[model samples]
Target: MYKLRELERIDLDRINKWRNDQNLIACLGAPYRYINEDVDHEWYEKYLHARNNSVRCAIVDDKQEEVVLGLISLLDINSINRSGVIHIMIGDNENRGKGIGTFAVNEMIKHAFYNLNLRRIELGVLENNLPAIRLYEKTGFVREGVKRESNYKNGKYVSMIIMAILREDYESMPSLRSENDE
Candidate 1:
Protein backbone atom coordinates (compact mmCIF):
# COMPACT_ATOMS: atom_id res chain seq x y z
CA MET A 1 0.00 0.00 0.00
CA TYR A 2 1.07 3.57 -0.62
CA LYS A 3 0.04 6.81 1.01
CA LEU A 4 0.48 10.42 0.02
CA ARG A 5 2.05 12.83 2.47
CA GLU A 6 3.23 16.42 2.30
CA LEU A 7 6.62 16.78 0.63
CA GLU A 8 9.39 18.13 2.88
CA ARG A 9 12.72 19.93 2.59
CA ILE A 10 14.63 16.72 3.27
CA ASP A 11 13.20 15.08 0.13
CA LEU A 12 14.80 17.59 -2.26
CA ASP A 13 17.96 15.58 -2.86
CA ARG A 14 16.02 12.42 -3.64
CA ILE A 15 13.63 14.30 -5.87
CA ASN A 16 16.47 15.92 -7.80
CA LYS A 17 18.17 12.58 -8.28
CA TRP A 18 15.02 11.03 -9.67
CA ARG A 19 14.44 14.02 -11.91
CA ASN A 20 17.76 13.39 -13.59
CA ASP A 21 17.33 9.67 -14.13
CA GLN A 22 17.79 8.81 -17.80
CA ASN A 23 14.70 6.60 -18.24
CA LEU A 24 12.39 8.89 -16.30
CA ILE A 25 13.67 11.94 -18.19
CA ALA A 26 12.97 10.26 -21.51
CA CYS A 27 9.51 9.16 -20.36
CA LEU A 28 8.66 12.77 -19.58
CA GLY A 29 9.58 13.68 -23.16
CA ALA A 30 11.95 16.40 -22.01
CA PRO A 31 15.68 16.72 -21.85
CA TYR A 32 16.92 16.65 -18.31
CA ARG A 33 17.81 20.08 -16.96
CA TYR A 34 20.32 19.46 -14.22
CA ILE A 35 19.97 21.75 -11.24
CA ASN A 36 22.99 22.76 -9.21
CA GLU A 37 22.91 22.76 -5.45
CA ASP A 38 22.22 26.47 -5.30
CA VAL A 39 19.44 26.29 -7.87
CA ASP A 40 17.83 23.29 -6.18
CA HIS A 41 17.97 25.08 -2.86
CA GLU A 42 16.28 28.10 -4.41
CA TRP A 43 13.61 25.90 -5.98
CA TYR A 44 12.88 24.24 -2.67
CA GLU A 45 12.65 27.58 -0.90
CA LYS A 46 10.22 28.90 -3.47
CA TYR A 47 8.05 25.76 -3.29
CA LEU A 48 8.04 25.96 0.50
CA HIS A 49 6.78 29.56 0.37
CA ALA A 50 4.23 29.16 -2.37
CA ARG A 51 0.58 29.37 -1.26
CA ASN A 52 -1.48 28.81 -4.38
CA ASN A 53 0.31 25.58 -5.35
CA SER A 54 0.76 22.35 -3.44
CA VAL A 55 3.85 20.21 -3.91
CA ARG A 56 2.08 17.59 -1.88
CA CYS A 57 2.72 13.95 -1.25
CA ALA A 58 5.62 11.65 -1.70
CA ILE A 59 3.99 8.25 -2.23
CA VAL A 60 5.54 5.99 0.38
CA ASP A 61 5.73 2.25 0.64
CA ASP A 62 4.17 1.51 4.03
CA LYS A 63 5.94 -1.81 4.61
CA GLN A 64 9.26 -0.18 3.77
CA GLU A 65 8.87 2.31 6.60
CA GLU A 66 8.25 5.55 4.77
CA VAL A 67 10.33 5.02 1.65
CA VAL A 68 9.37 7.63 -0.93
CA LEU A 69 8.57 5.90 -4.16
CA GLY A 70 7.24 8.88 -6.07
CA LEU A 71 6.13 12.53 -5.89
CA ILE A 72 2.81 14.14 -6.79
CA SER A 73 1.53 17.69 -6.88
CA LEU A 74 -1.46 19.86 -7.54
CA LEU A 75 -0.28 22.98 -9.35
CA ASP A 76 -1.67 26.05 -11.14
CA ILE A 77 -4.45 26.26 -8.61
CA ASN A 78 -7.40 28.57 -9.11
CA SER A 79 -9.28 28.52 -5.84
CA ILE A 80 -12.16 30.61 -7.11
CA ASN A 81 -12.66 28.18 -9.96
CA ARG A 82 -11.85 25.16 -7.86
CA SER A 83 -9.41 23.61 -10.30
CA GLY A 84 -5.74 22.69 -10.64
CA VAL A 85 -3.20 20.77 -12.70
CA ILE A 86 -2.07 17.34 -11.54
CA HIS A 87 1.57 16.35 -11.85
CA ILE A 88 3.25 13.11 -10.86
CA MET A 89 6.64 11.44 -11.04
CA ILE A 90 7.40 7.89 -10.00
CA GLY A 91 11.04 8.15 -8.99
CA ASP A 92 11.95 4.60 -8.21
CA ASN A 93 12.33 2.48 -11.32
CA GLU A 94 11.67 -0.64 -9.29
CA ASN A 95 8.40 0.85 -8.11
CA ARG A 96 7.10 1.70 -11.56
CA GLY A 97 4.38 -0.46 -13.27
CA LYS A 98 3.04 -1.48 -9.90
CA GLY A 99 -0.16 0.61 -9.89
CA ILE A 100 1.33 3.05 -7.36
CA GLY A 101 0.87 6.01 -9.68
CA THR A 102 -2.82 5.26 -10.09
CA PHE A 103 -3.28 5.02 -6.34
CA ALA A 104 -1.41 8.26 -5.68
CA VAL A 105 -3.31 10.15 -8.36
CA ASN A 106 -6.66 8.90 -7.12
CA GLU A 107 -5.81 9.97 -3.59
CA MET A 108 -4.84 13.40 -4.83
CA ILE A 109 -8.10 13.67 -6.75
CA LYS A 110 -10.07 12.76 -3.65
CA HIS A 111 -8.26 15.41 -1.64
CA ALA A 112 -8.81 17.96 -4.35
CA PHE A 113 -12.53 17.31 -4.47
CA TYR A 114 -13.36 16.65 -0.84
CA ASN A 115 -10.86 18.84 0.97
CA LEU A 116 -10.00 21.49 -1.59
CA ASN A 117 -13.51 21.64 -3.07
CA LEU A 118 -12.06 21.52 -6.53
CA ARG A 119 -14.49 21.19 -9.41
CA ARG A 120 -11.98 20.11 -12.03
CA ILE A 121 -8.55 18.54 -12.20
CA GLU A 122 -6.44 18.38 -15.34
CA LEU A 123 -3.11 17.19 -16.70
CA GLY A 124 -1.01 17.07 -19.85
CA VAL A 125 0.89 13.98 -20.99
CA LEU A 126 2.99 13.30 -24.04
CA GLU A 127 0.94 11.57 -26.71
CA ASN A 128 3.35 8.68 -26.80
CA ASN A 129 3.16 8.07 -23.07
CA LEU A 130 0.59 5.27 -23.22
CA PRO A 131 1.03 4.07 -19.68
CA ALA A 132 0.35 7.48 -18.16
CA ILE A 133 -2.56 8.13 -20.50
CA ARG A 134 -4.08 4.78 -19.59
CA LEU A 135 -3.57 5.48 -15.91
CA TYR A 136 -5.32 8.83 -16.22
CA GLU A 137 -8.16 7.25 -18.16
CA LYS A 138 -8.55 4.57 -15.54
CA THR A 139 -8.83 7.30 -12.91
CA GLY A 140 -11.68 9.11 -14.71
CA PHE A 141 -9.77 11.65 -16.79
CA VAL A 142 -11.01 12.07 -20.35
CA ARG A 143 -8.92 13.35 -23.21
CA GLU A 144 -9.96 16.95 -23.83
CA GLY A 145 -7.65 17.89 -26.70
CA VAL A 146 -4.12 17.89 -27.99
CA LYS A 147 -1.45 20.55 -28.40
CA ARG A 148 0.52 19.91 -31.55
CA GLU A 149 4.32 19.87 -31.41
CA SER A 150 4.23 21.32 -27.94
CA ASN A 151 7.12 19.27 -26.65
CA TYR A 152 10.55 19.02 -28.29
CA LYS A 153 12.75 16.22 -26.99
CA ASN A 154 15.25 13.70 -28.32
CA GLY A 155 15.57 15.60 -31.57
CA LYS A 156 11.86 15.34 -32.28
CA TYR A 157 8.62 17.15 -31.50
CA VAL A 158 5.62 15.42 -29.93
CA SER A 159 2.03 16.34 -29.26
CA MET A 160 0.89 17.04 -25.74
CA ILE A 161 -2.50 15.60 -24.87
CA ILE A 162 -4.73 17.30 -22.35
CA MET A 163 -6.79 15.18 -19.96
CA ALA A 164 -9.31 16.33 -17.40
CA ILE A 165 -11.76 14.95 -14.83
CA LEU A 166 -14.56 16.96 -13.33
CA ARG A 167 -15.86 16.61 -9.79
CA GLU A 168 -19.26 15.52 -11.05
CA ASP A 169 -17.70 12.75 -13.09
CA TYR A 170 -15.77 11.54 -10.09
CA GLU A 171 -18.84 11.66 -7.90
CA SER A 172 -20.63 9.50 -10.42
CA MET A 173 -17.94 6.84 -10.59
CA PRO A 174 -19.06 4.35 -7.96
CA SER A 175 -15.98 2.12 -8.06
CA LEU A 176 -13.58 5.04 -7.56
CA ARG A 177 -14.93 6.11 -4.17
CA SER A 178 -14.33 4.26 -0.95
CA GLU A 179 -17.25 2.53 0.78
CA ASN A 180 -17.40 5.15 3.52
CA ASP A 181 -18.41 7.87 1.08
CA GLU A 182 -21.85 6.49 0.24
Candidate 2:
Protein backbone atom coordinates (compact mmCIF):
# COMPACT_ATOMS: atom_id res chain seq x y z
CA MET A 1 0.00 0.00 0.00
CA TYR A 2 0.04 3.62 -0.49
CA LYS A 3 -1.67 6.79 0.63
CA LEU A 4 -2.06 10.31 -0.64
CA ARG A 5 -1.32 13.43 1.36
CA GLU A 6 -1.64 17.10 0.51
CA LEU A 7 1.24 18.40 -1.56
CA GLU A 8 3.38 20.46 0.74
CA ARG A 9 6.11 23.06 0.20
CA ILE A 10 8.62 20.52 1.52
CA ASP A 11 7.75 18.14 -1.32
CA LEU A 12 8.70 20.63 -3.98
CA ASP A 13 12.38 19.70 -4.02
CA ARG A 14 11.67 16.07 -4.77
CA ILE A 15 9.12 17.08 -7.39
CA ASN A 16 11.62 19.40 -8.99
CA LYS A 17 14.12 16.58 -9.33
CA TRP A 18 11.52 14.34 -10.85
CA ARG A 19 10.39 17.04 -13.26
CA ASN A 20 13.90 17.54 -14.54
CA ASP A 21 14.68 13.87 -14.97
CA GLN A 22 15.35 13.33 -18.68
CA ASN A 23 13.57 10.00 -18.82
CA LEU A 24 10.51 11.22 -16.96
CA ILE A 25 10.33 14.38 -19.04
CA ALA A 26 10.06 12.34 -22.22
CA CYS A 27 7.18 10.33 -20.88
CA LEU A 28 5.51 13.49 -19.57
CA GLY A 29 5.47 14.93 -23.11
CA ALA A 30 7.16 18.04 -21.79
CA PRO A 31 10.21 19.75 -23.17
CA TYR A 32 13.39 18.67 -21.48
CA ARG A 33 15.13 21.33 -19.46
CA TYR A 34 16.72 21.89 -16.09
CA ILE A 35 14.24 23.10 -13.50
CA ASN A 36 15.85 25.02 -10.69
CA GLU A 37 14.51 25.71 -7.22
CA ASP A 38 13.28 29.16 -8.10
CA VAL A 39 11.34 27.87 -11.09
CA ASP A 40 9.67 25.16 -9.01
CA HIS A 41 8.82 27.62 -6.26
CA GLU A 42 7.11 29.80 -8.84
CA TRP A 43 5.17 26.82 -10.12
CA TYR A 44 3.99 25.98 -6.62
CA GLU A 45 2.78 29.54 -6.15
CA LYS A 46 0.71 29.30 -9.30
CA TYR A 47 -0.66 25.95 -8.16
CA LEU A 48 -1.93 27.55 -4.96
CA HIS A 49 -3.71 30.27 -6.94
CA ALA A 50 -5.47 27.59 -8.97
CA ARG A 51 -6.38 25.38 -6.01
CA ASN A 52 -10.11 25.61 -6.65
CA ASN A 53 -9.61 24.07 -10.06
CA SER A 54 -7.11 21.41 -9.05
CA VAL A 55 -6.33 18.79 -6.42
CA ARG A 56 -2.67 17.80 -6.36
CA CYS A 57 -1.52 15.21 -3.87
CA ALA A 58 1.71 13.56 -2.93
CA ILE A 59 1.57 9.80 -3.09
CA VAL A 60 3.34 8.45 -0.02
CA ASP A 61 4.12 5.12 1.55
CA ASP A 62 1.39 3.91 3.87
CA LYS A 63 3.77 2.70 6.56
CA GLN A 64 6.05 5.70 6.34
CA GLU A 65 3.97 8.68 5.42
CA GLU A 66 7.00 10.90 5.22
CA VAL A 67 8.47 8.83 2.44
CA VAL A 68 7.33 10.47 -0.78
CA LEU A 69 6.62 8.02 -3.57
CA GLY A 70 5.35 10.33 -6.29
CA LEU A 71 2.61 12.75 -7.27
CA ILE A 72 -0.92 12.41 -8.61
CA SER A 73 -3.39 15.13 -9.46
CA LEU A 74 -6.74 15.98 -10.94
CA LEU A 75 -6.57 19.32 -12.66
CA ASP A 76 -8.60 21.70 -14.84
CA ILE A 77 -11.71 20.89 -12.81
CA ASN A 78 -14.85 22.17 -14.48
CA SER A 79 -17.60 22.43 -11.92
CA ILE A 80 -20.33 22.83 -14.51
CA ASN A 81 -19.04 20.04 -16.73
CA ARG A 82 -18.16 17.68 -13.87
CA SER A 83 -14.89 16.69 -15.51
CA GLY A 84 -11.16 16.97 -14.94
CA VAL A 85 -7.78 15.77 -16.22
CA ILE A 86 -5.77 13.23 -14.21
CA HIS A 87 -1.99 13.06 -14.12
CA ILE A 88 0.42 10.86 -12.15
CA MET A 89 4.16 10.49 -11.85
CA ILE A 90 6.05 7.83 -9.92
CA GLY A 91 9.23 9.78 -9.30
CA ASP A 92 12.02 7.24 -9.15
CA ASN A 93 12.74 4.12 -11.16
CA GLU A 94 13.17 1.97 -8.08
CA ASN A 95 9.68 2.84 -6.84
CA ARG A 96 7.91 1.89 -10.06
CA GLY A 97 6.66 -1.56 -11.18
CA LYS A 98 5.66 -2.18 -7.59
CA GLY A 99 1.91 -1.58 -7.79
CA ILE A 100 2.26 1.86 -6.22
CA GLY A 101 1.12 3.65 -9.35
CA THR A 102 -1.98 1.54 -9.59
CA PHE A 103 -2.86 2.09 -5.95
CA ALA A 104 -2.37 5.84 -6.15
CA VAL A 105 -4.29 6.11 -9.43
CA ASN A 106 -7.21 4.13 -8.06
CA GLU A 107 -7.26 6.27 -4.94
CA MET A 108 -7.28 9.43 -7.01
CA ILE A 109 -10.01 8.08 -9.23
CA LYS A 110 -12.12 7.28 -6.20
CA HIS A 111 -11.57 10.77 -4.87
CA ALA A 112 -12.52 12.28 -8.19
CA PHE A 113 -15.77 10.39 -8.56
CA TYR A 114 -17.00 10.01 -4.97
CA ASN A 115 -15.42 13.02 -3.32
CA LEU A 116 -15.28 15.63 -6.04
CA ASN A 117 -18.38 14.28 -7.80
CA LEU A 118 -16.64 14.37 -11.14
CA ARG A 119 -18.55 12.61 -13.86
CA ARG A 120 -15.54 12.08 -16.11
CA ILE A 121 -11.81 11.87 -15.59
CA GLU A 122 -9.40 11.90 -18.50
CA LEU A 123 -5.70 11.78 -19.23
CA GLY A 124 -3.22 11.77 -22.06
CA VAL A 125 -0.26 9.44 -22.28
CA LEU A 126 2.64 9.26 -24.66
CA GLU A 127 2.01 6.53 -27.19
CA ASN A 128 5.28 4.86 -26.34
CA ASN A 129 4.56 4.66 -22.65
CA LEU A 130 3.10 1.16 -22.83
CA PRO A 131 3.22 0.45 -19.10
CA ALA A 132 1.24 3.54 -18.24
CA ILE A 133 -1.21 2.92 -21.05
CA ARG A 134 -1.75 -0.60 -19.82
CA LEU A 135 -2.24 0.56 -16.26
CA TYR A 136 -4.86 3.07 -17.32
CA GLU A 137 -6.66 0.46 -19.40
CA LYS A 138 -6.67 -1.97 -16.51
CA THR A 139 -8.28 0.70 -14.34
CA GLY A 140 -11.25 0.99 -16.73
CA PHE A 141 -10.18 3.96 -18.78
CA VAL A 142 -11.24 3.58 -22.39
CA ARG A 143 -9.08 4.89 -25.13
CA GLU A 144 -10.93 7.72 -26.81
CA GLY A 145 -8.46 8.59 -29.60
CA VAL A 146 -4.95 9.45 -30.48
CA LYS A 147 -3.58 12.91 -31.07
CA ARG A 148 -1.28 12.07 -33.92
CA GLU A 149 2.15 13.66 -33.59
CA SER A 150 0.87 16.15 -31.10
CA ASN A 151 3.99 16.49 -29.00
CA TYR A 152 7.47 17.44 -30.04
CA LYS A 153 10.17 15.48 -28.20
CA ASN A 154 13.81 14.79 -28.93
CA GLY A 155 13.52 16.55 -32.30
CA LYS A 156 10.57 14.44 -33.28
CA TYR A 157 6.84 14.53 -32.90
CA VAL A 158 5.21 11.92 -30.68
CA SER A 159 1.61 10.85 -30.58
CA MET A 160 -0.43 10.88 -27.38
CA ILE A 161 -3.47 8.75 -26.68
CA ILE A 162 -6.44 10.27 -24.90
CA MET A 163 -8.16 8.05 -22.37
CA ALA A 164 -11.06 8.57 -19.98
CA ILE A 165 -13.37 6.87 -17.53
CA LEU A 166 -16.93 7.99 -17.05
CA ARG A 167 -18.89 7.73 -13.84
CA GLU A 168 -20.94 4.97 -15.42
CA ASP A 169 -17.75 3.12 -16.25
CA TYR A 170 -16.64 3.31 -12.64
CA GLU A 171 -19.96 1.97 -11.42
CA SER A 172 -19.61 -1.09 -13.60
CA MET A 173 -15.96 -1.72 -12.75
CA PRO A 174 -15.92 -4.42 -10.09
CA SER A 175 -12.38 -3.70 -8.99
CA LEU A 176 -13.22 -0.07 -8.35
CA ARG A 177 -16.65 -0.43 -6.83
CA SER A 178 -17.20 -1.25 -3.19
CA GLU A 179 -20.27 -2.86 -1.59
CA ASN A 180 -20.98 0.28 0.37
CA ASP A 181 -21.25 2.29 -2.84
CA GLU A 182 -23.87 -0.13 -4.10
Candidate 3:
Protein backbone atom coordinates (compact mmCIF):
# COMPACT_ATOMS: atom_id res chain seq x y z
CA MET A 1 0.00 0.00 0.00
CA TYR A 2 0.94 3.61 -0.42
CA LYS A 3 0.46 6.65 1.77
CA LEU A 4 1.01 10.39 1.50
CA ARG A 5 3.05 12.09 4.17
CA GLU A 6 4.81 15.40 4.77
CA LEU A 7 8.04 15.64 2.80
CA GLU A 8 11.07 15.42 5.06
CA ARG A 9 14.65 16.65 4.85
CA ILE A 10 16.15 13.20 4.49
CA ASP A 11 14.43 12.68 1.15
CA LEU A 12 16.13 15.63 -0.55
CA ASP A 13 18.74 13.65 -2.44
CA ARG A 14 16.26 11.20 -3.85
CA ILE A 15 13.93 14.00 -4.82
CA ASN A 16 16.68 15.91 -6.59
CA LYS A 17 17.82 12.80 -8.40
CA TRP A 18 14.33 12.20 -9.69
CA ARG A 19 13.88 15.86 -10.60
CA ASN A 20 16.98 15.68 -12.75
CA ASP A 21 16.04 12.45 -14.50
CA GLN A 22 15.88 12.74 -18.30
CA ASN A 23 12.58 10.90 -18.62
CA LEU A 24 10.92 13.24 -16.17
CA ILE A 25 12.49 16.18 -17.94
CA ALA A 26 11.01 15.06 -21.24
CA CYS A 27 7.67 13.63 -20.07
CA LEU A 28 6.84 16.45 -17.68
CA GLY A 29 8.21 19.08 -20.02
CA ALA A 30 10.56 20.39 -17.37
CA PRO A 31 13.02 23.05 -18.40
CA TYR A 32 16.37 21.68 -19.46
CA ARG A 33 18.28 22.48 -16.30
CA TYR A 34 20.13 20.62 -13.63
CA ILE A 35 18.69 20.33 -10.11
CA ASN A 36 21.57 20.19 -7.73
CA GLU A 37 21.79 19.82 -3.97
CA ASP A 38 21.78 23.58 -3.35
CA VAL A 39 18.71 24.03 -5.49
CA ASP A 40 16.95 21.25 -3.67
CA HIS A 41 17.85 22.79 -0.32
CA GLU A 42 16.53 26.18 -1.37
CA TRP A 43 13.37 24.64 -2.74
CA TYR A 44 12.79 22.68 0.45
CA GLU A 45 13.23 25.80 2.55
CA LYS A 46 10.79 27.76 0.45
CA TYR A 47 8.31 24.92 0.33
CA LEU A 48 8.30 24.65 4.11
CA HIS A 49 8.39 28.41 4.66
CA ALA A 50 5.69 29.46 2.25
CA ARG A 51 2.51 29.65 4.26
CA ASN A 52 -0.04 31.25 2.03
CA ASN A 53 0.07 29.18 -1.13
CA SER A 54 1.91 25.89 -0.93
CA VAL A 55 1.87 22.39 0.44
CA ARG A 56 4.11 19.47 -0.50
CA CYS A 57 4.09 15.82 0.37
CA ALA A 58 5.91 12.63 -0.40
CA ILE A 59 4.24 9.50 -1.63
CA VAL A 60 5.44 6.55 0.39
CA ASP A 61 4.96 2.94 -0.51
CA ASP A 62 4.36 1.42 2.89
CA LYS A 63 4.45 -2.10 1.59
CA GLN A 64 7.94 -1.43 0.35
CA GLU A 65 9.22 -0.50 3.78
CA GLU A 66 8.19 3.14 3.43
CA VAL A 67 10.12 3.91 0.29
CA VAL A 68 9.18 7.18 -1.32
CA LEU A 69 7.75 6.40 -4.71
CA GLY A 70 6.83 9.94 -5.65
CA LEU A 71 5.90 13.46 -4.57
CA ILE A 72 2.94 15.81 -5.06
CA SER A 73 1.96 19.31 -4.11
CA LEU A 74 -0.67 21.99 -4.26
CA LEU A 75 0.91 25.25 -5.29
CA ASP A 76 -0.22 28.80 -6.09
CA ILE A 77 -3.20 28.38 -3.85
CA ASN A 78 -5.81 31.11 -4.00
CA SER A 79 -7.53 31.18 -0.64
CA ILE A 80 -10.08 33.73 -1.72
CA ASN A 81 -11.18 31.48 -4.56
CA ARG A 82 -10.45 28.26 -2.69
CA SER A 83 -8.50 26.83 -5.57
CA GLY A 84 -5.03 25.55 -6.30
CA VAL A 85 -2.94 23.92 -9.01
CA ILE A 86 -1.81 20.36 -8.42
CA HIS A 87 1.60 18.98 -9.39
CA ILE A 88 2.77 15.40 -9.12
CA MET A 89 5.83 13.37 -9.99
CA ILE A 90 6.24 9.65 -9.87
CA GLY A 91 9.95 9.55 -9.23
CA ASP A 92 10.45 5.82 -9.29
CA ASN A 93 10.65 4.81 -12.94
CA GLU A 94 9.92 1.17 -12.20
CA ASN A 95 6.76 2.16 -10.32
CA ARG A 96 5.46 4.59 -12.92
CA GLY A 97 2.78 2.45 -14.54
CA LYS A 98 1.38 0.92 -11.39
CA GLY A 99 -1.30 3.55 -10.64
CA ILE A 100 0.76 5.23 -7.93
CA GLY A 101 0.34 8.62 -9.62
CA THR A 102 -3.41 8.34 -9.52
CA PHE A 103 -3.35 7.32 -5.87
CA ALA A 104 -1.12 10.23 -4.91
CA VAL A 105 -3.26 12.66 -6.87
CA ASN A 106 -6.45 11.42 -5.28
CA GLU A 107 -4.90 11.80 -1.84
CA MET A 108 -3.87 15.36 -2.65
CA ILE A 109 -7.31 16.22 -3.95
CA LYS A 110 -8.86 14.84 -0.80
CA HIS A 111 -6.59 16.93 1.36
CA ALA A 112 -7.25 20.06 -0.68
CA PHE A 113 -11.00 19.91 -0.73
CA TYR A 114 -11.59 18.45 2.73
CA ASN A 115 -8.74 19.72 4.86
CA LEU A 116 -7.86 22.89 3.05
CA ASN A 117 -11.45 23.62 2.20
CA LEU A 118 -10.64 24.24 -1.41
CA ARG A 119 -13.41 24.80 -3.92
CA ARG A 120 -11.47 23.63 -6.94
CA ILE A 121 -8.32 21.72 -7.78
CA GLU A 122 -6.71 22.06 -11.18
CA LEU A 123 -3.66 20.94 -13.14
CA GLY A 124 -2.04 21.31 -16.52
CA VAL A 125 -0.62 18.46 -18.58
CA LEU A 126 1.07 18.40 -21.93
CA GLU A 127 -1.38 17.38 -24.65
CA ASN A 128 0.85 14.58 -25.80
CA ASN A 129 0.95 12.93 -22.38
CA LEU A 130 -1.92 10.62 -23.09
CA PRO A 131 -1.35 8.40 -20.06
CA ALA A 132 -1.39 11.25 -17.57
CA ILE A 133 -4.32 12.91 -19.33
CA ARG A 134 -6.25 9.68 -19.15
CA LEU A 135 -5.42 9.28 -15.47
CA TYR A 136 -6.59 12.80 -14.72
CA GLU A 137 -9.82 12.21 -16.61
CA LYS A 138 -10.32 8.97 -14.73
CA THR A 139 -9.93 10.92 -11.50
CA GLY A 140 -12.82 13.19 -12.52
CA PHE A 141 -10.82 16.18 -13.65
CA VAL A 142 -12.38 17.55 -16.81
CA ARG A 143 -10.47 19.20 -19.59
CA GLU A 144 -11.45 22.79 -19.04
CA GLY A 145 -9.42 24.34 -21.85
CA VAL A 146 -6.15 24.26 -23.76
CA LYS A 147 -3.35 26.74 -24.20
CA ARG A 148 -2.15 26.26 -27.72
CA GLU A 149 1.60 26.30 -28.20
CA SER A 150 2.12 27.05 -24.55
CA ASN A 151 5.11 24.85 -23.91
CA TYR A 152 8.21 24.87 -26.07
CA LYS A 153 9.94 21.61 -25.30
CA ASN A 154 11.60 18.65 -27.03
CA GLY A 155 12.33 20.61 -30.21
CA LYS A 156 8.75 21.78 -30.63
CA TYR A 157 5.94 23.76 -29.16
CA VAL A 158 3.12 21.73 -27.64
CA SER A 159 -0.31 22.59 -26.32
CA MET A 160 -1.01 22.39 -22.59
CA ILE A 161 -4.36 21.12 -21.52
CA ILE A 162 -5.83 22.39 -18.29
CA MET A 163 -7.83 19.95 -16.17
CA ALA A 164 -9.89 20.66 -13.07
CA ILE A 165 -12.19 19.05 -10.50
CA LEU A 166 -14.47 21.21 -8.40
CA ARG A 167 -15.39 20.58 -4.79
CA GLU A 168 -18.87 19.53 -5.71
CA ASP A 169 -17.63 17.27 -8.44
CA TYR A 170 -15.15 15.69 -6.08
CA GLU A 171 -17.82 15.20 -3.49
CA SER A 172 -19.99 13.48 -6.02
CA MET A 173 -17.25 11.21 -7.25
CA PRO A 174 -17.59 7.76 -5.70
CA SER A 175 -13.90 7.08 -5.47
CA LEU A 176 -13.03 10.19 -3.46
CA ARG A 177 -13.56 10.84 0.22
CA SER A 178 -12.96 13.79 2.51
CA GLU A 179 -9.70 13.47 4.39
CA ASN A 180 -11.03 14.88 7.64
CA ASP A 181 -13.87 12.41 7.80
CA GLU A 182 -11.69 9.54 6.80
- Report the number of the highest-TM-score candidate: 2
Q: Candidate 1's residue-wise lDDT over 93-149, tens digit each?
A: 788899999999999999999988899999999999999999999999999999999
Per-residue lDDT over 142-161 for candidate 2, one digit per residue giving the tens place of the 0 to 100 score: 99999999999988999999
Report, for every candidate in turn, its global Cα lDDT versus the true structure: 0.85, 0.91, 0.87
Predictions ranked by TM-score, top down? Answer: 2, 1, 3
Indicate the TM-score of model 1. Answer: 0.92
Q: Which candidate would rank higher by lDDT, 2 or 3?
A: 2
Predicted structure with the largest lDDT when compared to the true one: 2
Candidate 3 lDDT, tens digit per residue, 39-151?
Answer: 99998998888856998888997766358889898999999999999988888779888989989988898899889999999899999999899889998999999999888
The lDDT of model 2 is: 0.91
RMSD of 3: 2.5
Question: Could you tell me which 10 consecutive residues in candidate 3 have the lowest summed lDDT?
Answer: 173-182
